[model samples]
Target chain A: MTAAEERAVIDRVRRGETEAFEALVLDNQKKVYNLALKMTGNENDALDISQEVFIKAYTGLHNFRAESRFSVWLYRMTYNICVDFIRKKQRTPVSSLTYTDDDGEYMDLEIPDTRYEPAVEAEKRELREALSRGIDELPQHHREIIVMREMTGMSYEEIATTLGISEGTVKSRLSRARQNLVSLLNSYGTFSKSGRHKTGKEVEGHG
Target chain B: MADCKKYMDMISCYADGELPEQEQKLLLAHLDGCASCRALLSAYRSIAEAAEETLVQVPDGFAAGVMEKIRKLPRRRSGGWKAVRPVIISFAAAAACLALVFTVSPQRFDFGRNKAKMSARVEAPDMADTAERGTDSVLMDSAVPEAGSGEFGGTEAAKSDEESLFLYEAAGASADVETPQTGMATATDSPAPNGAATDGQPVDSTSQVTRHPGVKLGIAGVDENTLVIYYAVFTFEGALPDHVTGVEKTDRGGGLYSLVVTADVARELINEGYTNYVIGNEDAETALVYYTED
Candidate 1:
């Protein structure tokens, strides 16, 4: 539906119509689910977070102002809920004392290349998996910007507004997040250890 | 290679298609000679592409599950001002409140970590609505004597307390007020609530609010017409009982809180020896719920 039609449906739902909300749930569920998955790195957690995002959106619809798109609003809720979950998860018994300290500096640790294989397909798999793992392991600030910008496709302006930071900060932080992810991927041997040999040509075929 | 370090942030913005034309050109020039940066940009693209393809199949009947949960939620229904005219409230403890406000007197307001300043606020969109709809509120009818006319029954103690007091648009809205003294009646506008309309004076919303909880927060009312009053500056002598929602450090900092209360919450606090510590009137403005464990 067009944005206008979506807003009209929201108004209808606000006035007590059930069907309008049901349709909204179906329309936006996939993006919401995927955004959650990117941030949490687990499908089960993503599904749970998706349901909560919609529930919060429905109950707090009155507080929503119309200046931004509903999707941005939905994504803001998704990011905040995901951050809460990550923080809670970090606080819980992490199951391994040797992993990292309170700062969760496991991202800075080096991992052996036990998972790496020489095959091209295996290399690609290793890269994607390492990327996901690296994203999960980054500091909270880095992970947040990467998830918002790279995973959710938010513009710098949208991100700055949602996060209440300057566009300059967004640019610098996103740069720093990418830099950290690259280093994390390198540590996991996702890059060829011998001179870091993967070239621009290899990645060009991805698009 | 170190020069490439400076382009790192620009590289990120470029990857997101956010770099300005001039900077993009500069970065392009740099990337031509730097094979590593090219690979990095390509890797960035690959990551973006992979993320786009990372869709998990949503479980069946997800929307149905959401709808079912939504159906169970209790919907809140409130009418606009025109329909709901019973939005005014009167404090039954106005006279008793006036008498005891002076008892606590004033201590140096260090606003210490161990001290929890309690306050409450009454919310109305505007006084114009209250003036138009408060007819059903007989308590409101008796309160609000003529504004700016010398009808105040305040004492020397009340006027002296007004120096630290500032008028607030709403009762208890200010958390940092060391003295909770305020009023709206009589010769001064210090009595916060009951004095808004004594001789049917139309409360001009444009009037500066200088409400203090110390003078007389009598008949504090709101559009709910739920009454709102705020008084904070509590000093608790002991640990809060379990029934008391334990010493939570609010987001602002430790040992400071402002709660908007209803008659029910006030009554609950009253049952817990709250009267000995502070004024525990049901529907109180919470003139001063300053709690601190010694």
Candidate 2:
């Protein structure tokens, strides 16, 4: 629904036409579910997050600012809930910065050969699966930025606002996330011409 | 090649069409010479394409279920928690003596599994105070609109004074929490050791766990995973702020548990970016505080 439509239904619900809230739920559930699903990587947890988000938005409707788009506000809520759930589930630090540990070994960024890249659109299904697995392998912060931008199509500004970070941080983190995914898929070597036992660059040649 | 790092960062923005006009020109010019960055951009686009197709079907009747729960919400008059909290605090202070009586007996109450059924009283003097608090709580409860016809206000209408006082905040967590009154604790698996239930142990057993529904609903808007924090001193930094009125060190070597405070204190912890602490075991008037050092 448009922000206006959302506002209208919200007014109706506030006016005691409680059923009108369902329209808001239906309008936002799919993307919200997709965002949640990608973040948690669990169907049940995703559903739990999505359902809870709407229930919260309805109950806390009064706190929503008039100038804000409900979708942005909704996605922000989704990100926060998933982050808390993630923090609770895995009691590890969800940091995005590059750091060296006590052992003096680099722990954050690892460089993979960009030359051995998968050919895009050559084998869509297999490439898709490779990407999915690659996403799962990413660090928690990387997974969040990737899902927010590439998967859920949130703009950098939106992601920055949603995550309470600067837009520059959003861009940098997203860059790292994509690089890590490419590195992962490169190791998979699904359509990499240089990969052993693969000669052709597949049908979709590199530009 | 050294400049490629800067251009590489721009490629992500470029793919999303978020790159500025000048930076876009610079990136495009750089891309002509940098095959690696070009490959990276292609990979980013391909990832987006695949993600666009990757979706989990919304479980059937999702909307209907949400509405079914929403329709059951209690009607609100001129207020919500904001309207009711102050009254509860003033009265809960009058009942403040119960805070001692409440904390002293831990196993007597089970905050989870709906196992809190402590009927035994301290004595007649405290009983008079307890009875007074109970009446004040009922008066506090009257500020909220009466619950809708359903499973609520059923067997709960006759719960003992302690149960009623403690359960009031759970009931206040959200509207949905009020209805499924019977099985609110249906999801909890680990019972958090009722033996030393009153001792605040800072444990982080993050294995897949569930909590009573009201606690979940209560922190849904702010922070959902808060109640999992086991203690204060281990996870919270610095000395307890002066606002932390009572700081009785436990026998567990400087460990502290069971903070009773007002609402703004809870908001302060949340706003200060302290993820480890959260409010719990609250009535309309007072709250149980858990702040973490980590």
Candidate 3:
């Protein structure tokens, strides 16, 4: 949604119109959910966090200063909520803290059968799983900044505002996150010149 | 002198197409003379492109979940400006009583341990210690008949005194002034449903009691019109509280808590424009009522 449209919706929402909020939710939910999923490396937690963030935005709307755009404010709240959850999890030291599928797994998208063979489906799933692991393995700070930059397409200034850090910090963090991601994706398999991962260059045979 | 760090950092910026012409020329000149810097720039450009490609496309139905959570929140009860008529009267009555209490005998209730315990309650990792707060302070003052009495050492009074001290610590938090930066409010000194005020004096309106004993308060009253308040209460693994049902949390970092409240509340807030706030009082200790209009 355009910034003006968002502002109008937010204005309507503040006036007690329930439907107006759906625009705000519909507009940014995907980005918010994707960021959570990437950061927590789990789907269920991401969904939960995304929902919680909107609820928080609704209640804290009173504190929403006009210095920043509504989207930036919302994103800032999202980052804070995610970090708070992680902090809570850390406070309780437990043995064998395996990343549960519910912890960071994305909701399994229902892929309609295009008459693809079972083996093709399996390969696709495996690729997704590999990508998920690679993203999950990044350091917490790096993973978060990368998600903000790449998934949300937020500028460095916006990211810094959301994360309560300097623009320089945002740039540094994004650079590091990208470098880490490159190394991770490369290790999973070689990337051909076309950017797709090549399981085996010879067998794929593009000469 | 060491070479300019800004000039060096410009290589990464230039690859991003973010460098000014002068800086870009300086970087290219440096790269021409320095193979290491050239390689570094190339590596950064590649990484930037890869990062751009690495973003995972967000899946569908994410908004539905966020909206769902916002729907579950409790609505705010706006009493309008005329509503303050009774509240102001009550505040006046309470102030008069306070003056009478002070004039009769100016007894300083030194909430020594009470203050410490209150701080701990507010900052404790969990809200478990909150219950022990009010019950302990009042018991301590009355039980200790004398400051250094040995007769009550092993008696029930001693036990009650210990409990009261615990409550006192939680109640006597540092006084908060009515400042713009932090508009803090506390509960008025009315009796709880089942217990008396632990401290002999009225529990000052400086420490607000949280609703749902173990719940920690988060942002309250989205705006003047929205009725629902949000709390970072309890552990909801992979989900928010049933009321805050719809949101999906993202990683924005820092010790921040965020949630989406329902559209109705959002609209109400927008219209009201944040003109009023109703902090927790004795009967309703946890909730704060804020309004935009009269």
Candidate 4:
């Protein structure tokens, strides 16, 4: 939806037209979810944060001020929530020990890849996994900036606004973040033969 | 024969189209002569391209799940107090405990002060010289050329709009000049132009510098990241100065405006006058105009 349409829906929701919020949620959920996923590096946390963002936006609708784009405001909330979540997680270390099921059998926790499909080609999966690992290795702040700029396509200005920083800071941080990611990817040997072959195949497939 | 290190620092800006025309041409020329820089640029480009091409799909029912939670939220007027109460209580309790402890053992407070004094005593000699040099640099950096005073000696007050724009743009470009990552902590620690006294200890020299009249946003104690975030919020809120020049919108629809103010306006805001006015609050009609240390 256009900004005007989004504003209208927000106005409706403010006026107790509760269903109107669904429009805003539907329009933004994918981007919000992706942002959370990128930051948290897990589907479950991403989903949780995405839901929390919409809920917080709904409840805190009055403070939004409409000074910035809705997406920028929403992303700011998402960024803060994710940062807090990460910090909280850091403070409390989780046990790696598996939980026993009702059958009294220990079950290995599996990382569910909801996006996985049998038809997905090998090269694409390898590249995605490599990129994901590279991204996961970054400091939380750097990762957030990269996801905001590169994945979400936020301009340096929007990012500065959302993250509450100057454009210069945004540029410097993003440049450093990218450099770090490149280094991480290099360490993974992704710049080598198999990776290069996959990349060529991936390019050819796109072409 | 431009320095490779300098050009390397600028490659990202060049790639982002953030470099001015002259700098862009200069970087392009350097790229032709330097093979290593070319490879670095290629690496950066590949990373950027891969990032752009890779798409992360949202899970099914993501919106529905969000909507379901939204429906469950109590349609209350304001939940701000409820959300903040726990934090407020925790802080209050901590403060009360500290007060109780201080009341019982007043000598403890003196011990703390003594400890601070001892540390300050150790650092005093070194800090004094650093402060003096810092002030000199601040003056040198902010000295604008006087109008009709040839090319080299007046404050920004003497410069015309075009001159102001040119100087400000040049400053902005150089402001992004990369330093070693380890340099950032020390860089931020350099004395603020206002020479804000730390721990209530007065720095007499701070008073010698002329204070420009007008609204001054004190940035002495705030951390760099917080300052940047506040500036962004101010931009979104549209709280910046009125006369801004050289407005350029980024590819993602945020504005970069050069905040040009005469010397007489205010000394603090003019410290790093230019702003990247990313987004403005539609209702508030204000832009973020917080200054960063040049």
How many pairs of residues collide in each model? 42, 5, 69, 18
User: Candidates ranked by lDDT, best first?
Assistant: 2, 1, 4, 3
True contacts kept of each: 0.24, 0.31, 0.12, 0.22
List ranges where model 2 is wrong by over 4 Å. Answer: A91-122, A191-207, B77-294
Question: What DockQ would candidate 3 receive versus the native complex?
Answer: 0.11
DockQ of 4: 0.13
Model 1, C-alpha of B216: deviation from truth (Å): 17
- Candidate 4 on A1-207: residue-level lDDT in tens? 998998898788877777788889888877788788877777888888787777657655654656577887777777766765675476221222122211121111121122322234664456567777777666666677878876777777778756656787777666656555555555665543112111100000000
Q: Can you write out model 4's per-residue Cα lDDT over B157-205, one digit (the tens) per residue?
A: 5323323322322321233322111111213444322342333322221
Candidate 3 residue-wise lDDT, B239-261, digit = tens: 32122322323222222222333
How high is each candidate's TM-score? 0.53, 0.55, 0.48, 0.49
Preferred candidate (lDDT higher): 3 or 4: 4
Predicted candidate 3 versus true structure: per-residue lDDT over A143-172, tens digit per residue: 677667655777777776555466666555
Tens-place lDDT per residue, model 1, A157-186, is 878765656788888777766766666677
Instruction: Give the top-scoring candidate (TM-score).
Output: 2
* Weakest 10 consecutive residues of candidate 3 chain B by summed lDDT: B80-89
Sorted by TM-score (best first), the order is 2, 1, 4, 3
* True lDDT of residue B121, candidate 4: 25
